[model samples]
Target: MVDTATNRVALVTGGSGGIGRVVSERLARDGMAVAVHYAGNEAGADEVVGGIASAGGRAMTVGGDVADERAMAEAFDAVEQGFGGVDVVVHTAGRMVLGPLTDFDLDDLDGMIRTNIRGTFVVDQLAARRVREGGAIVNFSSSVVKLAMPTYAPYAATKGAVDAVGLILARELRGRDITVNAVAPGPTATPLFLDGKDEETIGHLSKMAPLERLGTPDDVAEAVAFLAGPARWVNGQVVYANGGIV
Candidate 1:
């Protein structure tokens, strides 16, 4: 066992991009020493770390494939060696390959399952071991699971698995005072959403929400920060951070 301290340490998987980047920055800004983990985007991870540093916060980037257990272990090890025991883990690493279920390829489905469901289990297990008492674990899910939108079957299947895993993990950590929760974000305007779509398509989708706009990284980050900080009473729940998109 490592010596426990009061200062908080947060490890954010997928911290190099999208909502992961925003969450890492928000947590760091809130005075937590952050571990920014990226899968393949080292430069992007460095950029996030630099931004945090320039903002007078401490952070470092560690890269690994979240689907690999050994890699996740080393990533957690780096965080512990650099800061201390982890106090929070926000799992935002995910991949999506969308198509109608009738035409969806099994290979693509397998890939999605491996990255989203299996990867979350691996990360959460490591987090359960590494995080200290009073720690928080925030897992990412998609509001599509609730909306059951078409062409999102495979993706939502994985998130549905995530929801189940996260809820069970929360109860499993009951005596440890660690809270595990999942955030389901809808129509976030991240690179993941904007990388290929035309403006017209994006606009049409944005209007589907009651807020009548796409969500932002900062919007999702705020939810993560809440779960990581003063939301100790909030446990085992899948909170939708979407702008009433469901």
Candidate 2:
């Protein structure tokens, strides 16, 4: 068990990306020492870590494929060594390949399954074992899982599995004093979400939310901050950050 008095630590996978980057910084601002993990974008991860440091917060950078057990094990080891032990794990690493089911490439589907499904399992399994008592594990799902949007079948399938993992793991950790939950964000204005879209589609999605705007990375990050930091009772559930898109 980690000493409750020390600074809490967090390992955020995909800390280089849109939503993940914001989460890494937010956790740092909340006073946890953060390990910003990136699979490919080392520069982005560096920027996040540097910004945190600039803000007088504690942070470091680690890198690995979320699907690789050995790589992730090393990532965890580094964070444990750097900050005593991990208290929160907010897994935001994922892949998104949007297209209609009829024309979807089998290989694309396989890739999403690899990163989104298997990657989630690998990370969660480790968190279940390594996270300290009173720790939290937060995974990323998607609003598409609830929206049932077109061209999102493959992606949503992966997140549905994430939802399953969070719920079951919360039960599996029955008395461990840990909470597990998934955050499902709708139509966030991230590079990943905006990459191939046209203006019309973007406008439609923005309006789908009663807020009449797209969700920002910060918007979703607030939800994550609540789950990872002080929401001890919010376990085994999917928290929707979709701005009332339903």
User: Evaluated with lDDT, which candidate comes out highest?
Assistant: 2
Q: Give the lowest summed-lDDT range of ten residues in model 2.
A: 1-10
| Per-candidate TM-score against the hidden true structure | 0.96, 0.97
Candidate 2 lDDT score relative to the true structure: 0.93
Tens-digit lDDT track of model 2 for 171-233: 999989999999999989998789888999999988998889999999999999999987888
Question: Against the correct fold, how does model 2 do in TM-score?
Answer: 0.97
Angstrom error of the Cα, residue 201, model 2: value is: 1.3
Off by over 4 Å in 2: 1-6
| Cα RMSDs, all models | 2.3, 1.5
